[model samples]
Target: MHIGITGASGFLAQQIVRDALAHGHRVIPFSRRKGEPVTGCEPVRTFGPDIDLSGIEAIIHLAGESVLGLWTKQKRERILRSRIDGTRWIVDAIGKAPSRPSVLVSASGAAIYGNRGEETITESSATTSVGFLAEVANVWEAEGQKAEAAGTRYIPVRISLVFGKNGGAIPLIKNIFKSGLGGKLGSGKQWMSWIHLADIAALFLHALETESVHGPVNGASPNPIRNEEFTKVMGEILKRPTLFAAPEFALRLLPANEASLLLDSLRLIPEKAVQTGFSFRFPELRAALSDVLA
Candidate 1:
């Protein structure tokens, strides 16, 4: 199968592209910039609707600005525009292509079900939280729905926090723990829905190949842990003490209430993925951490 991917340089995209190549699939990376190479994949520089996607069997749209920075008004706009406009661009490009890809697997987030304290959320859960990210996710998914006009099967992946070595949130947390500054954030009672980077990549592949798995699929593990339990597990794996707590007030000062990433409780469940027969390689937090840190 020939696959087209955006955000080819992102941490998750790198792993997904590598896996796609190993499985005898051709990966053509689509980027906004020109002349940049993606190691083993074909890099196609495209702007707006001019993207050439002929002969592409599928597309994994991952282009977006990182949401980790301070949530200034400008930064928030960039984040919103990148996903909403970026997805619109991809959909428009697909509409104009000679042959539409069979599947469009676009990125979404669990944050859409904002701040559901202790509630287990599935793809069917309604959006209850009000914030920037919640609004962004709603818009992102809405834009992805446009791809269906071209008769393409659209699948929106509501991804959770992906943990792995050298990237994502794990390394930063590991560093904090290694420095003995790691502990539960705020009250540490919020539920955290997370997935191993390996499992998230695998879920992407599953969505790409499984025709029956359409619509919104939660990219998370079956096991969702509380913040305090998460701290304990990380501490146990690293054999370090987790005594320092990140007060909520300190995090609010960061961009987008950067602290919300730590304080908000989301008990997300991947019911669709499980019913679709997708198995997670690291469903347990301790094992997931050990593999990432190893």
Candidate 2:
């Protein structure tokens, strides 16, 4: 299969591209910037008009602005527009293509489930949260749905926090622990849904290859850990003591929307992925972190 990926330069997308190539699939990478070129793929700039979508069997749309920093009004618009406008462009290009692709595996987030306290959420769960990021995810998935109208099998992957050694949230958290400042955030009761980098990449491939899988798929591991437990695991893995804790008030100092990324609780479960026979390489938090750190 020939796969086209948006945001191919991104951390998770790079892994997906590598895996796709390993599996003998041709990749055409599209990005917002002209970065170092991918060796086996042509880097396309599609922020402007008309990108060629011909001969691509599948598309994994992952391009979006980073939602990690301070969410000022300007930053908030960029966060929302990047996903909404970027996806719109991709959907339009796919619609106008000489031939439509077989599948459209677009990126969404587990944040859509919002702060559902202790409730374990599946793909069937309602997106009831009205938080800023949750709203962004809702709109993002809606844009991906437009491809289904064009006869393309659209699968919106609601991804959780991705953990890897060099990238994703693991490195940043590891650094804090390494510096002896890692500890629980707020009440430390928030549930964090996370997936290994390898698992996420494999899941994208699974979505592309699996015919019966469609609609929203939860891209997460089966085990969801609480914030306190996650912090303790990080400390234990790094052979460091987690004595320091960040108070809720200190976190509130960040832009309210940005802080919500940390404070919000969501126990996301990948029911659809598991039901579709996709196996996670690192289903447990300790093993996943150990693999990355190794």
Candidate 3:
């Protein structure tokens, strides 16, 4: 399999490329910026013809700006534009290709379901959250739908908070812990769905090969833990005493009301992943944390 991936420099994207190559698949990295070359593929910009994705077996679209920044109006616009605009370029490229790729494995988010409180969301759940990220995720999923309409097998991977050593939410939380300020937010009982970066990268390979899994798929662990549980386990893993807590008011001082997302809860289950027989490498929070910490 010669996989063509966008955002090859991104944390998740890079992991996908590495896993693809390690599995004996060649990867063609599609990028808008100049990045260190990937081992199995050539790096080409969105407009360049140097790499033709038509020849590749699959396309994993992950190119987008980081969404964790302070949500100023300008920052929010950039977050939405990066995914919506970047996806348009990818769709256009796929349309013009002489031979369309067999599988289009694109990224989506658990955030698409928005803050459902105690509602356990599946792929079919309707998203009614009125926020910038909710809207961006909706548009992001639509971009991949275009490829599906074009007769390509499309898989929209809606990933949850991926916790790993170097990147994603865990490192930031680890840093806060290292700084002696690690604790839970809000009531700490808000449900938080998370996945190990290892499990996330592996899902790309699973979805790439598994014909049973397509359309919108959840990339979270089947076990969804509360924020308090997460804080406790993380504190244990790092051998630090978890003591402090940040209230909702403190977070509300930040931009875009994104603090609500941090403080709110969503209990997401990987129903499709489990039903389709895709087992998680790190199902429990402690095990996942230990593996990443180790």
Candidate 4:
């Protein structure tokens, strides 16, 4: 398979590319830069609607502005526009392609479910969650769905909190716990759905290869943990004391209600993946953390 990946240099994209290459697939990395090389892949300069994707067999759209910083008005606008516009461009490119790719594995987020408390979130769950991140995810997935009109299988992977060694949120969380400043947010009862970097990468490949797997696939482990339990495991792994906690009021004081990202409870279930015979290497949080921290 010849795969075209947007945001190919990103943390998660890099892992996916490595896995794809290991599986004997040709990777074409789409980049905004004219001649920047993506290691071990064919690099293409993509800018605006005129972009060409002639022979690309599949596309993994992962380009977007990071949602980690303080959500000022400008930051919020950037986050929304980057996803909406970037997805729109990809759909347009697919429409114009001489031969449209068989599948499009675009990135979505578990935040689309919003603060669902203890409700088990699956691909079939209602996306009635209302908030900035939720809205972004909803619109982002909708835009990617447009590719289906061009005769492509569009699978929007609604990703959870990704745990990895070198990148994603784990490094920062590990650092905080190592410094003994780590603790649960709010009441610590909120659910957190997470996936190891390797598992998520493999899930993308599974979705790409499996024809029956369509629509929104939850990129999370079968076992979702509470915030308190996650904190406890992190402390145990790092041999640090998690004695502090970030209260709701203090978190809400941050710009643009960034507290929701931490406090929102989503007990996600990868029902589609499991039903389709996909296996997870690290289904438990403790084992996943041990491998990542090691």
Candidate 5:
């Protein structure tokens, strides 16, 4: 398969590109800058509708602004605009392409479910949760859905907290725990859904290859852990004490209440992936953490 990947420089995208190449598939990375190139792949530098995608079999759209910092007004706008505009550009490019890609594996977030305490979220779950992130996700997915109108299979992967070595959230969390300052956020009772970086990257390939999978797929493990349990596991893995806790009020007082990203409970399950016979290599948190830390 010839795959066209946007945001090829991103951590997740780089993994996907590597996996795709390893599986004997051709990868063409699309970047906004001309000089930037992804290793071992031909980089196409363009972002507008006129971008050439003729002969690209599938596209894994992952370009977007990072949402890690304090959610200031400008930061929130950038997050939303990047996804919305980026998806729009890709969809438009698909429409204009002489030969459109068959499948579009776009990136969404599990935050679309919001703070659903104890409720297990699946692809069928209604996205009624209201928040800045939720709104961004809803809009982002909606934009990606436009490709369906152009006779493309649009699969929006609703990603969870990604755990990986050297990238994603794990490295920072590891440092905090190593310093013995890591602890549960708020009451630590909130459910946290996570996926190993390898599993998430593989799931994208699964979606690209599987014909039965469609629409929004939850990119999370079957076993979701509570915040306290996650903290405990981190402490054990890092051999550090988790004796601190950040109260909810204190978190909310932070700029733009970015604490919601930490405190929001999303018990996500990969129902569609499982039903379609996709398997996760690191389904358990402890094992996943061990492999990542090692």
Candidate 6:
């Protein structure tokens, strides 16, 4: 299977490229910046003729801006436009090709189910949060919906916090831990759906091959760990005492929109992925943290 990715340079997309290539799938990586190997896969600037249709099995759409930045009007526009416009371009290109890819594994986020407190969320869960993130995610998924209507085998993967040694949010978290500053955020009881980086990469491969998974799929582990639990476990692993806690008022200095990501509660479940006969590589939070943080 030949796979092409939009945001090949991203942390998650880079992992997908490596996983696909290792599985003997030909990968045509597309990124804004060219002439670089994103996770061992050489990335090209343009989505070329070679990637239009023939022999292309799957397309992983992960290109988007980091939503953690200060949501200035322009920055927020970039965050939304880059995804919506980029996806629209890809959808247009896919529509023009004689033969479209069998499956389009488009990227979304679990933020769509925003701040659901202690209630466990599934793929069918309703998004009631009026936060900026939920709104962003709503529009992001709509961009993929256009592809699905075009007769493309579209699947919007709503990913959670993917933890790996490098890249993703884990590196920053680890750095804070190494400095002996690891502790709870706000109340620290917020639920965060985390998956080991390896599991996320594996899930993409699994989705590409499996025909049964077509719509929205959750890219997460079965176990959703809480903020306080994660901080406590991480502190224990790093052999550091988590005595200092970041107050919500102090956290507002970084970025306002990002606070929602850091402090909110979301008990997400990977119901669709687990039901597809796909086994989790690291099902427990401790096992996942140990591997990535080791």
Name the regions of candidate 2 deviating beyond 4 angstroms.
Answer: 42-47
Model 4 clashing-pair count: 0
Identify the candidate with maximal lDDT: 4
The all-Cα superposition gives candidate 6 an RMSD in Å to the true structure of 2.3
Each prediction's TM-score versus the true structure: 0.95, 0.96, 0.94, 0.97, 0.97, 0.92
Q: Kindly give the stretch of ten consecutive residues in candidate 5 with the minimal lDDT sum.
A: 42-51
For model 5, the superposed segments whose C-alpha errors exceed 4 Å read: none
Tens-digit lDDT track for model 1 on 23-84? 78899987777666888887666745556778898999888988875678898889999898
| lDDT scores in order | 0.88, 0.88, 0.81, 0.91, 0.90, 0.81
Off by over 4 Å in 3: 43-52
Error of 5 at 236 (Å): 0.5
Comparison by lDDT, 2 against 5, better one = 5
Runs off by more than 4 Å, candidate 4: none
Alpha carbon lDDT of residue 188, candidate 5? 98
Model 4, C-alpha of 133: deviation from truth (Å): 0.5
Q: Which ten residues in a row have the lowest lDDT in candidate 1?
A: 42-51
**Residue 108's C-alpha lDDT in candidate 5?**
95
Tens digit of per-residue lDDT, candidate 3, span 1-294: 778888878899878877888898878888776656666676554524344566766788888888876777888888888888877776777787887778888888888887878888887778754666677888888877898777788888888899887887777778898777989998898999999998899997888888888788888998899998988988888888889998878987876778866976878888877888888889998999898877
Per-candidate total of colliding backbone pairs: 3, 0, 0, 0, 0, 0
Model 3 Cα shift for residue 107 (angstroms): 1.1
Comparing 2 with 6 on TM-score, the higher-scoring candidate is: 2
Counting only residues 3 or more apart in sequence or on different chains, how many pairs clash (N, Cα, C under 3 Å) in candidate 3? 0
lDDT of 2: 0.88
TM-score: model 5 vs. ground truth: 0.97
- Candidate achieving higher lDDT, 4 or 5: 4
Off by over 4 Å in 6: 37-55, 252-254
Q: Which of the two candidates, 3 or 5, achieves a greater TM-score against the reference? A: 5
Error of 1 at 204 (Å): 0.5
Candidate number that wins on TM-score, 3 or 4: 4
